[model samples]
Target: MMMRSSPFWPLFSQGIRHRVLPRSSLLTPRRTVKTLPSFSLENKTCVVTGSARGLGKEFLTAFALSGARGACIDLSQKDCEASIASIASQVQNAYPDDPVPELRAYECNATIESDVKSTWAKVVEDFGKVDVLVTAAGIVDNVEAENYEYARWRKMLDINIEQGHFVLAEEGREMLTWHNIQGSIILIASMSATICVRPQKQAAYNTSKGAVQMLAKSLATEWGPRGIRVNSLSPGYMKTDLIKGLLENEGKELVGSWERDIPMGRMAEPHELRGTIVWMASKFPTKPVNPA
Candidate 1:
């Protein structure tokens, strides 16, 4: 004969069900959802190296439009001043009712460690604290490896690695630490770091950018625990002043080849990266997400 079920069997089943399923009040409604964090950079101070022109200026302009006080660092004070003025004018025109964030020009040769340190000191003194840094100061050369000179290669690494990226990152880290601020650092790497671009023999340039990507990873590991975010932004071919001469003259055919290689059939415009720059500078990501 089958044994009779315990009288408490229904209560035991109900208890198990109660433990497994959340209470009605504890469950979130289907319509309720987490909202995206604001990408606004209001009241934040930003520093952009190589901000006089090209991709650097584009990043700076994006920061300015997002309501960040900007420090435009370049090799030429005159150029930085001019660029900042132009950015300010555009920002004013775009937001007629809103106050234009303060933008300052600081001349700093990024390839020189002393200059970078001194300039960073000034930036900290002026801005009180730096919340974001974008190292866009770098050089690219297309010399065939077979005939590449030692001096040229050394210069390429010096500008793109030693002083350009590492030194600036170190200084920025110090400033952030001193101010007890958890900040963002964006290293402007290149797609060439991972892919070999055709029609260009830039062994030195490629090596430098590869190092940059690695540097970002290394720094992220070291600084993440310190609440500092380090990431690399590897943009592909872009229509910027760095390649204006090449695109306009001898490298016209080269540009065509680059465009064909690109899935979109054209190089990117500097302004096209504006939204990306702002988002990266914002607190949304909160963690490092290096993009190649």
Candidate 2:
């Protein structure tokens, strides 16, 4: 399989969309988003795909801390349940009386329309409207570009690109008839979408994210009319199992020393990505409005 190269981006940004989208196109009389008010996630329900571990786990943590009733969905069903159990147990240990997040786990394969539909049916049955949708479900392989496995490469496209589009499309359909409420959708991309990965075979993985970047903006345009905000959150390399072996090779010289190359002087921590997810996912405020 021949893999196409990816370009750097803010795929959420439509060249001509400052007018229709929920987002402000530029600095104006109103405060910039940077200076905008922070909203609470208390009692709001959120769903995170691929929430069993890694970036998904970080998203779980962020939503939990922000007071969302979070549901962690993953193809690895058992592992997903274990993660929820562990997090719930931790909160029980740390804060006995406070309201812990109403967290649930569901086994879902985003690539399968049946799974996406059924899982979402259950999720909505449990928690009414899906104000936020975060699709982190993806897989990676380590085959050389020239010798990438045909089967693995195709499967990668199924999970990474198709699954995202399928889930987003499904969610958009549901949100359309929703009670005029606002919604947010976020897809996770990678730095590989910008820089060409090297020294290993990740052509499939890189290509998937590259495709996802554009899919997000197209959705933003279509769904913006319905008060939906769709965006992509791209991450730099992080210390996750996908790249653990590649980084941990005895003398790779990149493993524990990657901070040397990062402009911030450090490999990303699990907590680092959470802030962005939480900010974008939970956009509603919880407080009494002050009348001027």
Q: Highest TM-score, which number?
A: 1
Q: What overall lDDT goes with each candidate model?
A: 0.76, 0.67
lDDT of 1 at 73: 81
How well does candidate 2 score on lDDT at residue 57? Answer: 75
Model 1, range 149-202, lDDT digits (tens) per residue? 999999999888876564556555675557767888888999999989889889
Worst 10 residues of 2 by lDDT: 16-25
Alpha-carbon deviation at 273 in model 2, angstroms = 1.6
Instruction: List candidate 1 stretches off by more than 4 Å.
Output: 1-37, 169-172
lDDT of 2 at 162: 86
List TM-scores for all candidates, in order: 0.85, 0.79
> What is candidate 1's CA lDDT for residue 260?
88
Candidate 2 structure quality by residue, lDDT tens digits, 150-254: 887899999999888778877887888755557778888877776675555588888998887778777777777678888888887776655565565534565
